[model samples]
Target: MPEVRIKKRFSALAGAVLAAALVIAPLTAAGASAAAPVLGTVGTIEAATSDGNHESYWQARYASYNATCYKHSLTESTVHGAVTDGGKTVTLAPFQSSWPGNGWAALIVNSGTSNNVIVKPVAGIAYASPVNNGGQQATVSHWIVCKGTLPTPPSVVTPSLTFTPASCLAAGAIVFGQNVVWSSVKNADGTTTWTASPKAGTVFPANVTTSWTVPDLTKLSIDLEGCRPTQPSADESETVKTTFVCAPPLATITTTTTKTPYDVWDTTLHKWVAGTATSSDVVTTRPLTADEQATCEPEEPELPTTTVDTKPWVDGSWKCGDTTVLQTREVITTVTPTEGEPTVTKTSEQQTRKLTQSEIGTCPLVPGKILSACVGDVPYLSYSVDLPEGFVASSEKPVTITFVNGHGGEDYVVTGQPLSGKLLWPGASDAEPKMWPGWDLVDGQYVETSGNYAWTRLKDVVVKFRVNPEYETTVTYPEATAECANPALTSVTPDDPTDPTDPTGDPTDPSDPAPAPSVTPTPASASTDNTLAITGGTIQLGALGLGALAVLAGVGMTIVSVRRSRKA
Candidate 1:
């Protein structure tokens, strides 16, 4: 039925006038005891609105399809009116067994803002046989008319804020730690923008932006060089200064012992270490003292000495003695007035802090598709992993799965109907072959003789898998009907070619020699004979034999007109 609404200025007057003609009063049975008064009774139900904000009407046109029923004989089972205002609804009393007429029947609703006029189908309509003498099944229809906007309700909210540490992968050097407050607002386009403000003694900028399609957390960083003091180096005035002086009364030789400091190699550190030393002594002549020079003798002869051999018949030689000289000469001394350049050792420092943001929105769950199927009275479930829609998976890790058989999420098998034979998927692969159930695998498929049989018969299989800790999904394979086609035979024993039942004569019988085998190169081009015969080990040339003959001829075999038969 079509419904039409027209706007009217005189809503209050129009509602009252329409109620007299359209509204039907509820009828009570004669002598019916009053338990509770029925709905839609005139004078018992009050009008929803006296000063109407809007006004409209709806009519339901129905007809009986049975031949014996008149067009105006059908009536509505019940009728009720509901008024909605300020998000709250109130239903007026209903009219029962009403609206049986030739023309349109009106059900008035004293409505404000929005109204729903409901009409229910009667239990039965009088009709002739073949329709079962009952009314056809019908559904209740609702007609609504809404105008003036309703008042919106106030939303209740509790303010909350949180701070979380950043992950090791997302953390950076010199990460600033700050006590900040964050607030988020949803935009009309379904995107969310997050703003942050630092508290006392805190420094940094934080931000987050997200939407239904994408989520992004901003990484905040501030350059410390802009506000911090500059690093300093050692002063140049601390460098060491050295000088040398040479002035003495006479030349002198001094003997002294000295230790040389050196560094040793450390194998573990792969570097040199200092503080070890080696000592030695040296001798030289000194100048004569003033008291010893007063008693000194003049002109003493100097002699040299040599090694002498004391053995028999050996000669000894004498030489001049050694001499020493002292003279007025210069002396040298080295001095350092200051220390050398200072070594400045600098150590690196890394400061880091964590960052976290509130969750913005939720992602709609996408259902996974089941890829399992049955082949030849056997079920082979898909062990392959795939990411569902609205999700992205990382390739760094493998997907883990659990297979469940039967119903009610429990494992079950029929006592007498245990499974037989293996479920084979010829070229299919399992991610974890070792973990596969009791089945002997050949290539990638299951072999019939052996199998990891957990269930005798798989009516349904449930697959639960997880791509990672964050994403877990479940999919199901419903009952399947396998196409169990009959297997074809590979080879068959030949029938007696000379038997009377055989139509085609024998080619191996010499009494009636058969024509020579066809020399057609292409086996597909040859006409086939249904008869079968054998001469020695070879059979008569048939569809497949024609190709063999061509191969033999290509190998330089002579083609003969008559074929050989078995010797008697």
Candidate 2:
């Protein structure tokens, strides 16, 4: 896109030069009496107007790309520039090349514009052809057709460059934020004058700086012409050169899990946080220690118990065979019971146990400590502490659990249940009066007497629990007493037989004959009235409907009688 614009600007400049040259041609022909022996020199004279301004001490710089021959060579210009088409052939024109002290040597830039006029030198002039550089590809060309001098550089604008951030690891791009852009100015000399791309807030002769949000790139290239350190005469055009500082996305940490310094859950984040302190903070769980494992208790043990089987005995019953005498059938059920002693083996576990002479101890409820009888003595043991089936343990408080060292070493008992409440100390008795292993333990039931106590944890945590108080059920117990009067009967009528022979009427003897029922007739009951009467809240349908109809008829007859009396 930039190249196309450059060409158009030069084309306009060239056309104007040709027009002015043609105009001068007629004059040259009229004055001279001979055909010109040399090719026509393109030139432009100052117009009738003046700006009263001058360009100060102009300078030049050398720049190059691959020359026309593909070899490197320095050209006396910033970018390839030309007035007319540089690719076309043109006749030579005379121009003075004052390089440093190398005074006035007839030279021309070939291929493209080798130099541009900062201050319109004398009347603007252009070569008909590119300057010859010995090598075919190393030629610089400049064709100028000017009016009075190249239009004074549009305006000197200091090229200001900056990046959005200045650093990033993403693609960087230069975007216009602020600054004046240079424009191509067409001159009557048949040449185009263009200034550097504009920067916001730029003033003539003053350098301006602006900001741009660079894209995800590392480098930005601005291509334009007429910008050089040596040239301070005109507002040289520029494509812009912005240096961006980019920070790309952090790299992933490629280190494997085992080799990684951090316990990073995601390896990709390693690069991002590699140098940070958090790099060592990876997702992980603490391992269980040997002592910690000792605190854990295994699943509840399977208690040994026996299964019993028994056949029920059904007695004989008498039934009428649909006629005369009743017959009896007896059913006898055989009973068989399985008997055997269960082989029970207790597995060793890490648990805190009450200290005992035996290697193992059992937790059960009793009056006091297990006993060796004293003169047929009653054994007194401590009441067992247990959780009810529906009990959801809130917490466990320490209650001097004895840690026993078995054949293995140390057995530290630990239940998975969490602890709650406060620590239980020594010399504290249980909630009830119970015998300890001995009178000595009675005072220090919870205290560790042996120095070895510190080696193992006494984790007998007592759980304080309760059921919903409102749900308590109270049962009333009837007092037992001897009854000599009569037993209240159920499903029996008053005429039911008591007994025939026993004067005491005791029905205990099954062999005794049953007494016949006796009922006395009541004369009042003999007065037969088969009617079902409607009383209470009940309405006898058949009787009720008929009674209602009768009442209605009687009311109608009375109403008619009254009406007749009134008429008479």
Q: Identify the candidate with maximal lDDT.
A: 1
lDDT score of residue 247 within candidate 2 = 20
Top TM-score prediction, candidate number? 1
| lDDT at residue 360 of model 1 (Cα atoms) | 8
lDDT of each: 0.27, 0.24
Q: After superposition, how far is residue 87 of candidate 1 from its true place, in Å?
A: 99
lDDT of 2 by residue, 1-568 (tens): 1212234566567556645644554565566555422222322212111111111111111112111111111222212223333433222223334212212112222233223222222223433332222212212223222112122235445544433432323333343323556344555654344445554444445444432222333332221121111312221111111111112111121211222222222333211111222122123223334543333334413222211222122223211111122222222222222244544332221222222211111111111110011000111111113332223334453222322433345543333322211111122222223111212222323222333223221222121112110010010011111011112222223233232121222111112222321211110001122121221121122332222213221010000000000000
Please give the distance, in angstroms, between residue 303's alpha carbon in candidate 1 and its true position after superposition.
Answer: 99
Error of 2 at 523 (Å): 96
